[model samples]
Target: MFRLNRLTDYAVVVMARMANDGCKVRTAPQIAEDTGVPLPTVAKVLNALARDGLIVSQRGASGGYRLGAPPERITVAAIIQALEGPIALTACVDGQSGHCESESLCPMRGNWDRVNNAIRGALEGVTLEDMTAGLFVPMGERRSPAALQQASGK
Candidate 1:
């Protein structure tokens, strides 16, 4: 099964928390608390994200981190790339020279590239905004608990 490693999954959770919070700079501890990811893991994910230019870091008394760009401009593919490198399902599709062992006899060598590109394209279509769209209601649209229960036929 194609799956994201734990760190990549944590990174996405951390990023979603940030996107939900908007452009405000958030401390590592705050992010850890908000996302329920461990502080050390949050710090590690933040470092990788900042290094990849996904989030900007500041060093000072009031310093923290914020997204490098708007949520709508950042795609899921970019986040995956930032945390996990390229999204190649196999070595042959990675586009690196001389990395695969079966280059001589592999019939599915170039075919994997097509599959990889399709996956990448699908991920690129989803943005951070898309991921957190239904997480919260606007202030004007919020209803009381009773109203919510009634609306849901509870």
Candidate 2:
């Protein structure tokens, strides 16, 4: 099965949290508390993202993390790559060279690239904004829960 690891899932959730708040600088502990992820894991995920420029880090008394770019400018593929490296599914593809014993005889050896690229393209179509779109109110249409409740005549 093609599956992303737990850290990648956490990375998406963490970044989505940052994106939800307009990429505001947030401490790792604060992120952990808000996202319900463990503090150590949040730190680790933030480090990985910072190393890849997916997130920016600040140092000293006000140190914290934020997205390197706005949510709409960042693609899901970039996030996945920052945490998981390239998106190729098989050893025979992605320029890895000869990890598979049957590379010389396998008919499907060179075909996986098509599948990989298609998947990458699909992921690229989705932005962090797309990921967080339904999580809260829109820019102009923002409304509080109480307001919505009263409007519903509850």
**What are the runs in model 2 whose C-alpha is more than 4 Å off?**
136-154
Model 1 ranges with Cα > 4 A deviation: 136-154
Candidate 1's TM-score = 0.86
- Local lDDT at 141 for model 2: 92
Q: CA lDDT of each candidate?
A: 0.87, 0.88
Give TM-scores for every candidate, taking all chains together and pairing residue i with residue i. Answer: 0.86, 0.86
Candidate 1 at residue 90, lDDT?
Answer: 88
- Indicate the residue-level lDDT of 133 in model 1: 60
lDDT of 2 by residue, 24-130 (tens): 78999999999999999999999999988989999889889989999999999998999999888886666566698877888887799899999999999999988
Tell me which residue pairs clash in candidate 2: none
